[model samples]
Target: MTSSTRNRLFALGALLVAGAGLAYVAFGNIGQNLVFYWTPGEMLAQGSKAYGPTIRLGGVVQPGSLRWDAAHTHLSFRVADTDQPGAPSVPVLSSETPPQMFRERIGVVVEGTFDRSQTFTSSRLMVNHSNEYRPPKPGDGPDKWKTTVSAPTAEAR
Candidate 1:
């Protein structure tokens, strides 16, 4: 091969290797930052494999299972797969105050790690509101929606 051709080939091979290395590093960082959300049942199904990495748990807060400290610094609750009765639930403990919208039977996503004790220690809690807009039921009366809508203006004096 000619000297010019040999130098060109060497440069092309170096470019290919550099591109591959760059792609590898980009994907490696993405894989490390990709967090997954799992339901209680799904996480429980993982058994011992679920204990290490931080994961988001999505579910409904089980009714009557919430216990909050007086100072509002600590809270614990059981999260169920769904609002339906008898659904599987996992206990969650969070150091932060529950959001104002957080309430029993509402959907929530808690981000944290599951410990050997089977409790999820969450560092963040997010309330998941339904996207569907529901209108008031028939015969519910306008009073039921007073808080959601502004009152009608009285005639100007």
Candidate 2:
């Protein structure tokens, strides 16, 4: 074989090895890194298998189950796959203060570990929101925020 053919063969072998390494990593036991989040029902379905490893729990906030102390430092709420009352729910306790937009019936993802006790202790709390934005109408007032912004007084002018 000519020098060029030998070099090409060596390059092909290197490429194949690199590809195999990547495949192993992508398909390997790195489950925790690739998984984004699991729905509440899915997590619950895991049964005993879901007890360890920090995982993201994604679901809707269960209405009437959200509670926060007066200081608002700690929060507790139930998450379900949907806003319906009958959906499977998982109780979650979080130390992080909720975002301003967090509310019942909204999508949320909490990252934490679930114990055999059936409670999820979350270290981080995130509120999911749509990327779409619709600005207020041209003449719309501060009512959009449910607050009043008084116009500049004539006396000050």
State each model's CA lDDT, in order: 0.80, 0.82
Q: How close is candidate 1 to the true structure, as a TM-score?
A: 0.62
List model 2 lDDT by residue over 1-157, tens digit each. Answer: 9999999999999999999999988887787546689988989998999999999999998877777655657778899999998999999999997766676788999999999999999999999987867767888853543231122121112
- Displacement of residue 125 (Cα, Å) in model 2 is 0.8
Which pairs clash in the backbone of model 2? none
Which regions of candidate 1 are displaced past 4 Å?
1-36, 134-157
Report the Cα lDDT for residue 52, model 1.
89
lDDT of 2: 0.82
How well does candidate 2 match the true structure in TM-score terms? 0.64
**Backbone clashes in model 1, listed as residue pairs:** none
Q: Relative to the unseen true structure, what is the C-alpha lDDT of residue 44 in candidate 2, on a scale of 0 to 100?
A: 94
For 74-119, candidate 1 gives per-residue lDDT tens digits of: 7888899998878989999998656566777889999999989999
Number of backbone-clashing residue pairs for each candidate, in the order shown: 0, 0
Largest lDDT belongs to which candidate?
2
